[model samples]
Target: MSEKIKIVLAEDEPSLALIIKESLETRNFEVIVTEDGDQAYNAYISEKPELLVLDVMMPKKDGFTVAEQIRKQDKRIPIIFLTAKSQTQDVVDGFKHGGNDYLKKPFSMEELIVRIHALLNRVENNQGSDDGLTHIGGYIFDYAKQSLTYDGNTEVLTYREAEVLKHLYSTKNEMVTRSHILKEIWGDDDFFNGRSLDVFITKLRKKLDKDKNVQIINSRGYGYKLIC
Candidate 1:
């Protein structure tokens, strides 16, 4: 029998937290719910869950802070930020602080389940090479570590960033359509996800800039090409 997937859910509201925990438990997931950011962080350290669902607003450290701390220890864990705020900057900040996905609050259980499955499947299927390292131009992309090293300087990447880079590297020199990447990584090719993809591409360019020969070029109406 397969082991049950474990998840750490950090939400402050007692009613909402209980509902989420019960819903996930019904689906056979091992859910560990924490009421605040500090407890959430501690739960994460002890539980070592497969995924994390963090509410953006909480007592003590907030979801972003918890995510930041966790990223320092484990770069590849999938983190989904839950927020009531729909501000563009808030969304951007979530991604900036190591979030792989975002789910606005007042969400449906089905939607949450789908996001959880998409993240887990992506991580499971993309655990590249035994050593978890790939070479591109003069840089080394460490898949497991979620980092890129150039000239001995390593730039640690967020989980989503590593996944995006890995996808580009797999089909280097070929035109990979934006829709394909969005569907493959984000599980959707909608406008919001498209914008998020653009953000990740921009971040990748800066990290890979140390090597002059590497570039991620856009194809106007089509998609992007990784020119290495």
Candidate 2:
């Protein structure tokens, strides 16, 4: 039999933590549950789990802080934020701190499992395309390095940012709805996620602004069209 995929879960609520752990275990995942941020970081460092599911609120250290600390060392380990703070800025902050996906509180076990599966599949599929490269406007994007280079300059992008840009580039000149992007990237199309998608779009606009030929146009209440 293949080895079970390991997961490090940091959640302060005992009942919720227990439920998530039980659910993951039933799905054949090896879960290490921690109630505080400190223990969660320790578990991550020692156990080296394949994925991390973290709550934004925790004792000793918050999920954002832990994620920042982890990102300093490991950039590719998938991090998912589980929090009740669904505000636009909060979601932006979560992504800035290294979250690959966000799940608001009151989420269902099935939703969480589906997200886990989607993320794991994405990570696995990305491995085979490490050397793939794409051209967007005047910039050269290297998938393996997660970087964009233009005119002798290169900027390394965060994992989520790279994914968003790649998707936009793939469908350049076509309209992509906010809900479609949220579902494709974050696995949900909630209000907070809609706001978060806006944040990412703003960042991508800034990054691709140097190329006059590349434009990300907001369709106002509909979606965005990336023209290159």
Candidate 3:
């Protein structure tokens, strides 16, 4: 099954926040909640959730400011605004404030579900296959869902493992030096970092063990290569 859609919700109303949160969770959506606009922005910056739901009137910065800050850096991620204000001016301001969709308060959970699914479907339809699953031996990867399947007994890869695999694929037919992998991914090449890389290489090797022709060649004291 695909991973649950991750949502970051920022609402100041405790009761309403709980209701929305429970509704989302009940639908198997992973949600991160914050009561203030600033906290919401911070969570988004760090987590990079799939979607955002912000309340219009929030503590610390207000929904408009929060949405504006996020849009400044990322224009692709979908955003929705939730509010009690339903006037024409408020609706106009909400869009002007950078929300992809606006939901007036006293909305039903079912409506929220419909809106969330609509946005998710739009994003998915436009998104091409994930870069992570394009090639590996003769098997294709499913990056968004993190699975490797052929005949049966599919294996799931962790986020870090998927990232490492993607980077290695990008360097296919060329040696990816340990130094570069360290700096590019871990941003460190200390003793422990080297050990960590070794561990990752071991795990990746195990995953590709089924295919004998494909190889991740170790360059000994220098780098690694993804050989086809």
Candidate 4:
């Protein structure tokens, strides 16, 4: 059976939200609608939707805060920001905050639908799993366990770490851009996440350094290359 596209839509404009909800439902998407950022965050945590459509201007919290919190817990969910602020800085700031795609107010429902499908498609491509396991250097990755065992001792990895390692292992010796890492491991790209990624890189380096044969090569502002 085909999986239903799960969506969390947070729009304070009730009429706009309803229009988007109906349009998505007509396309067979499973949607959870909310009117505030707090409710959006609740929907994200409780329902764990596949995709999120957030509005910047909302009561309780803003889309940026909601996205930031979500990034800390779940990194593999796509996010789209819908807002009326068309300023250059606002658009740049949205991407810097964790938006996969940005849409201004009064957007065509059809365009929004297209963007949704495209984001979901990209997510599907990145989530493609092969073999369910990968071995690098002296480490044998148990993707299912989200743990790395070296020298008979196992170290538990955070969700993002595991996903990042797995993808890196799969694409060993290739240049995996930071954007690719964010999209595949955290589902969005932003400033908060950009810093978190550095921390993850440090942790990963420490974890795999025990085995000299395994190296996570950093390409500066680029990404990582897992060498075995």
lDDT of 3 by residue, 1-228 (tens): 158878999998889889999999999898999999999999999878999999989889898899889866765477888989866566546655556566878999998888777767756764764534476777677666556665566887653465567778879989989998876554446554566567668887888888887788898989999887
lDDT of each: 0.88, 0.87, 0.77, 0.79
Off by over 4 Å in 4: 128-228
Count of clashes in candidate 2 = 0
lDDT string, candidate 4, 56-129, tens digits: 98999999889878866755577889989866667656655666667788799988888788778766775655
Question: Which of candidates 2 and 3 is the stronger one according to lDDT?
Answer: 2
Backbone clash total for model 1 is: 0
For 25-94, candidate 2 gives per-residue lDDT tens digits of 9999999999999999999999989999999999999999999899878777889999898678888899
- RMSD (CA, Å), candidate 2 to true, equals 2.2
For model 1, residues 1-228, the per-residue Cα lDDT tens digits are: 138889999998999999999999999899999999999999999988999999999999999999999999877788998999887667778888989888888899999999999889877765655246788999999878878888888988877788889889988999999999988877778777788788889999999888889999998858999989
Predicted structure 3: clash tally: 0
Once fitted onto the true fold, the runs of candidate 3 whose alpha carbons sit more than 4 angstroms away are 128-228
Clashes of each: 0, 0, 0, 1
TM-score for all predictions? 0.91, 0.88, 0.55, 0.59
Worst 10 residues of 4 by lDDT: 126-135
lDDT of candidate model 2 versus the reference? 0.87
Alpha-carbon shift of residue 174 in model 4 (angstroms): 13
Q: How do these models rank on TM-score, best leading?
A: 1, 2, 4, 3
